[model samples]
Target: MTDSLGQQKPVNIKALLQACRSKEETFKALVTLSKTLPRLSAEKKTEENKVKGCESAVWLVVEESHGIRHFKADSDAKLMRGVLVAILSLVEGKMLADIQKMDLKAELAELNLSSYLTSSRTNGVLAILNKINTV
Candidate 1:
């Protein structure tokens, strides 16, 4: 669905965050979303644009128009792809400053994902933020 600004709106981040806070719900949602994402294929993969610090290979592409930022990402890992979807859904088309100000760590913590994420996956998340910041 589109928001008032006519940009695609995400599945509600607040609701997702809350669900993540509940162990059973978070696991269920993650599993469901992860299953839904298409797996990365050799033909679809790009080398140069791949995120550097992730344990699992991840590629993120960004586009901006009229002050709105859009992102497309793919990952070799299903769970990571789901995480990317969750993050992108929250920030896509949002103002840069607002995106920058977002307490992603806190939000993830609320979902109990903060502690479970690998250092590499955390870095991948930061890489996404850096990409958005640059746009």
Candidate 2:
């Protein structure tokens, strides 16, 4: 496969986030992030709100307040939930124009998160962002 591709992808050497962080810290942050998730009732977890490309069950809901978009997202996977929180935290109170202009890849990468995500998870992030932009 590498011979066909011509070159192997350069491996990133960053420590996995889950490895560096304590389980207690992870649990606490997850609890806080989940508690802060914009209210998505159980009834709202229908196919219409689910992010299509995510391997995990991710549901997103948006409300526009005076041109600012407030996004509420949830995922069954703990990792995905954290990703949602990281992305949503940026645009939560910002204007739509700001959200559109935001470089989430750079932002997430700077936080050393991009290295931890698998290709599918990265795709899921894109899907989540696309849903935000379109809606």
Candidate 3:
């Protein structure tokens, strides 16, 4: 991925997840990007999109148009929002078929991301993955 001038585009969280240097740095980056996820509209924040099994309420909305999935999410907790952003970074704009082929748990494990989270929060991430993959 590049710009018109052929400069390498900044690697996204998906790439960051693949990096081996410092998992803490990658988690920090996820947290930073988490702040960028826009708040879901009142109309969009419904039970249908809400994720379960988390300490906080997390809502994820998956929409597909022309075979590409658009992921939108929000949470009352910052770290959970980071989780949502990380999830969205992996799959947003990707085709459903492509997303289905992804092994998110392994990717997250590669970063040792679970170490930064509680077991239940980790399970929440799994639930988020289930929601995204099922869509």
Candidate 4:
């Protein structure tokens, strides 16, 4: 898969899962990627759209253009922001069918996010997936 920037993007789920498994590298990668994402606007993030069950308030907005989905998200907590970035990096610019087919629970487990995350944060991850499904 390729992005709007003409860069070849990782489409294989296993490769992305492996990338997220490296704690140090994935953390750095997330932070760097987050810096490049467009900032979420206040209008784009309404109370109703805020991800529920999250320890920190998180907002995710999904937009589809030319048959590809693009995600933009923000969070009050830095770590949550990194987690969102990591997840979004894997999904964004992909077809909805591909996103829907992904085994997110297994992928998260492979990344060991469940072990590192709190119960609320784990729920927040599910909430993100729910939102994606809705889109």
Candidate 5:
């Protein structure tokens, strides 16, 4: 996908997953990606963008251009921010129908992240996906 800067690149998921020989490696890679994710300014992270069900304050805003959704998200916690970036990597810049067709749960499971999350965090992921669908 091309970013706002018009730089063409594939989503980092597959490569990062493949290169991670251990869970620790995967976590490190995800953290690095999270740090690079676009962040919302304090002004943009208003109540309107706040997502429920997350232990930390999480916010998301989506805009559509030419039928593709572009997501901007942030979280007060590092891990949640990483998870949000991973989720956005899959759904952003896709058509709503295509996003809906994706089995996000299974995809996340493949990353071996779900088993490591608390129930609340899992619910937060669901809430994020639901919010994306609504957009």
Candidate 6:
């Protein structure tokens, strides 16, 4: 099935991130992406799902089938929601071994994302990544 982005069922999220030339362009893309991404239900955004270090409320749910992991996430803040979706896009449907081996920090650095994020936001993203790794 096609996702909201209307490309193909299998999207290359890394390629999408790599396409952004600068931090400003990335944020602009996030604003547009926020409008298109599907959100989690209110019930699913409970304290249990909350990402611990985020300034805004964020939730992530991971489902695994056979060998692939599926991730669903949401955030109260629109920009944060977009950030979560961008992060999720990178790892959703990945196998456990691939997920563990992936260097998310490297990817973020390549995207020049740290220059645009506050310490809290960085920690929050790390917390989300940690959760994904352990799952």
| Residues 1-135 of candidate 3: C-alpha lDDT, one tens digit per residue | 533322222355556555635766766766775677788898988988888886789998888889988777899887778767666766777898898898878766654466667888888888999988996
C-alpha displacement of 15 in model 5, angstroms? 2.9
Most accurate candidate by lDDT: 5
Q: What's the lDDT for residue 129 in model 4?
A: 87
Best by TM-score: 5
Q: lDDT for each of the candidates?
A: 0.66, 0.65, 0.73, 0.70, 0.77, 0.72
Off by over 4 Å in 5: 5-11
lDDT of 3 at 47: 88
Q: Say which prediction, candidate 3 or candidate 5, comes out ahead on lDDT.
A: 5
What TM-score would each prediction reach against the true structure? 0.72, 0.72, 0.79, 0.74, 0.86, 0.82
Clashes (backbone N, CA, C under 3 Å), per candidate, total: 0, 0, 0, 0, 0, 0
Each model's Cα RMSD:
3.8, 12.5, 4.4, 3.6, 2.4, 2.9
The superposed Cα distance between candidate 3 and the true structure at residue 131, in angstroms, equals 0.5
Model 4 Cα shift for residue 89 (angstroms): 1.5
Please write out the lDDT profile of model 4 over residues 1-135, one tens digit for every residue.
446633225443335435665666666654654454556788978986688878888998888899888877888777677677657766878889998899877666655455447787788898888888776
Candidate 1, position 95, lDDT: 73
Give the least accurate 10-residue stretch of model 6, judged by summed lDDT. 1-10
Evaluate model 4: give its lDDT: 0.70
Q: Rank the candidates by TM-score, best first.
A: 5, 6, 3, 4, 1, 2
Candidate 3 residue spans exceeding 4 A from truth: 1-10, 14-28
lDDT of 5 by residue, 4-122 (tens): 62322334565565567776887886687678676789998998899988888999998899998888899988878777777777777889989899888887776657544789888
Candidate 2 least-lDDT 10 residues:
1-10
lDDT of model number 1: 0.66
